[model samples]
Target chain A: MAENREFFNRRLHSLLGVFPIGLFLMQHLVVNHFATYSPEAFNNAAHFMENLPLRVFLEFVLIYIPLLFHAVYGVYIAFTAKNNLRRYGFFRNWMFMLQRATGIITLIFIVWHVWETRLAHAIYGTEVNFDMMATILESTFMFWFYVVGVVAAVFHFANGLWSFFVTWGITVTPRSQKVLTYATLGIFIIFTYMGIASLIAFAY
Target chain B: MAEDHKTIRMIVQRQDEPEAQPYEEEFEIPYRKNMNVISALMEIRRNPVNAKGEQTTPVYWDMGCLEEVCGACSMVINGKAMQSCTALIDQLEQPVRLEPMKTFPVMRDLAVDRSRMFDSLKKVKAWVPIDGTYDLGEGPRMPESKRQWAYELSKCMTCGVCLEACPNVNSNSDFIGPAALSQVRLFNSHPTGSYHKAERMDALLDDGGLQNCGNSQNCVQACPKGIPLTTSIAALNREATLHSFKSFFGSDYHH
Candidate 1:
């Protein structure tokens, strides 16, 4: 049973977790930042990908397929998980619940983001040029939406970084895990600020 | 921190069995001179009375050493997981709450089956294999700095507090959790234990071992021993990467 479980877990890690999530994070950060320098730059980048057969194929096969599987599996596990939160104490329970809540929020945001940016372009003839994004972002509502999105992304990444190390058997020492968790959070905050600043600058 | 002796109420969440439902029982223990939550629990156990002025079964719990070293007496007091041994009643709120750490299977009211953690330790071979029983004395010595931190890592009491605090450790995942991972570090750092380092590392590198942790840093805050859990996980990450690289290259690596 243990061996089978381990096998199943490894399969999930490779297909659903590391490659899809990590690649998406890196690409999302890079693309979002690029939009700040020049609206045309982002528009060109978006168009270039949309026009590429190989890129489109890879995105469909590698990104979307695994992403959907992982999200569904995550929700399933979360809902089925036993209520250990109330067993220990408040902070513990809250942290346990927070991870699940954030994961759900991220899933919701991802769907909406994809719909607004990608599906809308394909189905509704909605323009998603860098300028359009900037214009929408200039509104206080959308600005805050982007801000909240960035914060959630940062928290998710930082927390996931901490979890990833433990999951991979990289840093097992308590002291080391603590230090790295703090360091990861610090790095997350820095990137989040950068990403937010770029958004404000691009919009205004 | 004044000796302001004031009456405080305590609410304990209790369950009879693993499958049984949980219920809350309140007790009003007299404010003592210098009492912690453990002492308050002790007082209630001594009297075996509830707020309703009725006789009840003695509230059950587990404790080894009265000091914080044992980690056996760990409980959620006032919504925080820590050693009940060290919790001061005077420093707590008026109506404090207590509950068992939820990560492990509850044996009774406050006692839990922490065998899951111990089993993980066994699975990872969290120990050094030494030669024959007699006289193989003084195997090896580590650097002072390394020894100091290793000692800190060795302080883990198999307490499930960290596990209870973690979001990743649950029934859905077989996550061995922070306590076991820290133990892996403890044994892996040993010069003799390093021989089995590959096995331990491989175990952690596998599913429900390392990949399940969602680093919220709550474990550190929840840990009564204040073990640097995240730091150890980071170092293990670097080591695992190096190990993976070595494995990929099929290089001759020394323990």
Candidate 2:
């Protein structure tokens, strides 16, 4: 029984990465891209999300719960696994290390980001609109931090999707894995571009 | 002209006993043509002298089949997990560093307890089952194409090098590592072994099985036999998925 749970836990970790977390990131990038369109559109989208019926419950189930599980389990995996980049400097080995590193950075950024935005808005009932994001991004340090955090998050999700395929038995053959590698790289480029564009929208 | 003299320097990580802390010891041996790491160690063992010209206890290590076949001589040589018998001194940089493979507990000097690997092999049942001691009439023949990969898989000598190179297999984690996972593919492919396929697949679905693999791809590169460990793992993942589906519905579902 214990053994089976461990097996399921690992698969659950991979599944959560693609479903709610990866999907959430993609949805977030698209919604934030509304800022590039107009501040009014961005505010409307944010307002819609914030005012949904059972909004707190939805966030707890769809976002916070899954994110907490993924992040905590990710940290456990990173701590337990050894990094062999110095001896075996294979491309995949380096990717494995980078995945863990980005996970750590993304966790820190997400915690701070959530505390700064969502929690503060919830507790103090602060207006979370276009002006608030623009104000936050106006600071040089905060802007750079968001850029780094976005880049790390994008890479983690993209590279994680590639590993997800292998982990879940979706890409078995070497040829298929190679194709997925290119697809994953394509994802990284596109999502990163979207993330950077969204951040740039705040800068102006 | 004075005859030119040459010597090789090696820094060996040593432990007095299993419970003792590890320490580094330097030894210098007269250079010999085509000397392997094991040969250099033998020279040091014979002399039992430190580079500072002080008397010391003979260094201990494990070896068998002086060739790489037995897998008993695996250790971390110059930051790489490999057979000491195959690691040539000429190819290695000066001050070659030797340490026991950290994936397994250090027994002493350069030897380690590889019982974990053997235990994993048992977990996966990496063998063909037979009815009795008497010879069973000719077993089914394997097709040449399938036989080819099976032959490749059979080359695993239970060397802990793959375990060493793997990031997932470590002290804190209960991961069984790549060797046993590859063995699952090998044994399950056998005609008679296939009879117990469900059992093996179930074992793989257990904890410390295929799920522990993080897809680092180091095991394939670090394997001295080049056993294609990751490919086997990916294949096993597919099989396990199918097995789970079959279990969920019925065995006849796949049939």
Candidate 3:
């Protein structure tokens, strides 16, 4: 029984990654896209979000707790993992690069996003209203920053999702994996479009 | 049949201990009907004789289920890392070579340490949390679609062949490799296992977890069981994104 603890833990960890991460990407892109419409639309969406009492409560119990546990544990596994990619060369090298690139981008973007939306409001009374976002986008520096951040976020999200599918065994057949990759490509393109639209709306 | 004239010689890299110096040894095994590399090694183990007519120590390696289910018996065969038990001798050229997988620390002739793979599995918490082992009556049922993929991921044997075949797994890096990544997919697919899905996604987002897989996809090509190792990695990437969002809003998003 004790012997299976590690096995069970690994299984749970993989499970924990699927929902919040997957859901986050979709919501982030959509919410940001509200810039394409109007501040009223954005606030309406936010209001709808605010009214979800049980869901909000569940967020603390489910999402936050799991994220902290997984991130900390991820550091541990990564530091201690055995690397063996030197044999064939090219493919492994690229995989490592993408992984690193996406992680860094996602990390930086996440911090900035939190600061811009959550923390800024909490500490400095800086409202993350639609007008503020529009103003921020008007700045050349912020526009490019969001662009890079979104690109990094998109690539990281898609690639990581593809990898996660394989890790979870959803891609057992070569055909199935191929199908999933196509879906990944489709989702990535759509999300990219959404992100760009939001950015342009803010700028204009 | 004129085909009976073909013969093969093998050059094997061998070591007797972790601290011992490595050396090359040669063996010539007669081609037989339905022969595979593991069978050839078994012959060498039985006879303990080399191509030079010198008596030698029996070659040592690791193996479990011969059907590629256990993931043991994985080694570099003819420069490609795979399961020796399934490597058909007939498919190989003459004088085939064998060695322990380079991505891992070699323990002996063809055996390497795979603790890192298991450790990654641990970091991911790849299991359902049953309060206790004592008759936890029926668990939650999973959707048929998820069960299908979960069944597939369960086939992993943690042979470390994927690690050996990957170019990123090396001395300087801490990549957890593909086998463990695939295992993460296996557990995350479960209905009960979904409870910890976010944690697993976070693990991949972290260093040396999924970030280290360069998508060379050699592990998929190298796996004897034909598990879609790369595909699982991709799916996890998407899942991680969703996980990130749910984390941000502090909400219960996934149904």
Quote model 1's TM-score: 0.75
Q: Order the candidates by lDDT, highest first — what do you get? A: 2, 1, 3
In candidate 2, which residue ranges exceed 4 Å CA deviation? A1-3, A47-57, B1-4, B132-136, B251-255
Q: Return whichever of 2 and 3 wins on TM-score.
A: 2
The C-alpha lDDT values of all candidates are 0.74, 0.91, 0.73
State residue A46's C-alpha deviation in candidate 2, in Å. Answer: 3.6
lDDT of 2 at A27: 88
**Candidate 3: tens digits of C-alpha lDDT, residues B18-113:** 988989999877667888988989889988999999999999999898987887888888777888888998898778899888677889999988
Between 1 and 2, whose lDDT is larger? Answer: 2
Per-residue lDDT over A8-103 for candidate 1, one digit per residue giving the tens place of the 0 to 100 score: 454375345657775577566667676777777777777776677797788887779888877887786567455545544454346456656776
Error of 3 at A148 (Å): 25
DockQ (C-alpha based) per candidate is 0.30, 0.73, 0.11
Which sections of candidate 1 miss by over 4 Å? Answer: A1-53, A61-103, A113-204, B1-8, B131-137, B248-255
Model 3 quality (TM-score) = 0.57
TM-score of each: 0.75, 0.94, 0.57
Per-residue lDDT of model 2, residues A1-204, tens digit only: 354877778888998999989998998898898888899999888777778899889888889999999999999998988898999999999999999999999999999999999989989987898888889999999999999999999999999999998987888887898899899999999989988998899888
